[model samples]
Target: MSEYFIAVIIGIVEGLTEYLPISSTGHMILVGNMIGFTGEKASVFEVFIQLGAILAVLILYRDKFMDMLRPEKLKLVNYKENGLSLIHVMAAIVPVMGIGYILHKPIKNHLFSTNTVIIGLLLGSIVMLAAEKFAKQHLIDDIDKITVKQAFLVGLFQILSLWPGFSRSGSTISGGLLLGMSRKSAAEFSFIIAVPLMGVACLYDFLKIWKLLSISDLKFFAAGFAVAFVVAYFSIIWLIRFLNKSSLASFAIYRFILAGVSYYYFFIR
Candidate 1:
């Protein structure tokens, strides 16, 4: 297949899977294999193209980003009163950064294999299903009320995404719900946390493969990034609106089906 065609396919996969709690890294790996883009190039592409999704989040939440950087307006208020959600976000990022730093090479070598992806898909689906069932009984009603303790717990869960199939958004959001954060709140927090995490991942991957990249390769990467950004921006908007009125059960069901199908294709059948 042509490089441009492969780039477009990867771009589509990135846009769809990045925000859906289905593990964008897992999907990209699978798609990369099917499309004859494997090994280090595929890995770097998967991470690098995620900049598109990160940009989507920034554009969608521009106002929140601004508030996070400059909060002098509420300096007189208590920590919780000054829109300190951003600080909690920073706190939540620390564990994953530390863990990821420690395990980066190992994960890239062994944990990113197809078998690991399959297992991640299955296990993450189970977790999502259980979280959905729990949400029905104990729904969190407010996002602003999330405690630092709860944020840290959610961050811990987000660390699970270091595994190929375990989604960053799914684990963190589920953690938020379990900690009594409302679904919308959980989802929002999940989105917010993704910015720094994905940014770092993209940068790490690029630096790793910098010597291998060519100008033509950069063009393809930019094309993929642009496509992903447009799709992911709309997806973020739609997901937020849908979550306002719906349960996370739908995404849970989707994950289960995806996992089952992937297992069938890769192992059983």
Candidate 2:
């Protein structure tokens, strides 16, 4: 297959799985390996295409993004009284930024190996399973009621997502539930937090590999990005609506299946 075709496939996987707690990174890696796209080039492509999904979120939530940028909203009284939602989102992003910055090079160069992805998939599945068990017993009724402390703690949990297959959305959403946010709220926050975090990651990877990218490669990248953005916009909307009525247990089960399949392919086969 042409690199462009591979790009399209990667984009579709990224779009569908990015916000679903199914680990877009894991899917991309597995698919890339399956298609014989490996090593640094594939890795960089995976990170860069995430920009497409992040752009989808920004476009879909333009009003929220605009509100977050208003100067007056940054003031103490206004922020505390009316801007708390955006503020909490900002708070949730800080730890990930700090932690990601500190570990970016190490993660990219060393920790992003296939073995780590497998371990992360298995462990992350267990965490999701645990979160589901907890949610069955303790349900939070509202998303807006999420406290700053809770957001920060969720951000802390998001730190785990730095590992491939840990699923940034999954860790953060599960963390939010554990911290008392409703599933809908937790999932929403996870999507919102992804904007800046994934944006930075894409930009960093793009800059790092800029010299190696040809004009043709750029076209392939753009095609992939467009696919991811279009698909992710709808996926985000659908997931939020679905979570309002459905259980995350299905996702937990899916994760278990992914882990089993990955294990079988990597070890049993």
Alpha-carbon shift of residue 198 in model 1 (angstroms): 1.3
Instruction: Find the candidate with the highest TM-score and give its number.
Output: 1
Model 2 lowest lDDT segment of ten: 135-144
- lDDT per residue (tens digit) for residues 126-205 in model 1: 78777777754444565556666777888898888999899988898788777777778888888888998788877877
lDDT of 2 by residue, 1-269 (tens): 98788888888999999998888877887777778888767766777778889989988878877876688666656565563466777788899899888887898778666677877877888897788778533355654566677778899999988898899998998887677677788887788788877777778777887777667677888888899988899999999998788766788778778777877887789
**Whole-model Cα lDDT of every candidate shown, in order:** 0.80, 0.80
Output the TM-score of candidate 1.
Answer: 0.92
Runs off by more than 4 Å, candidate 2: 136-144
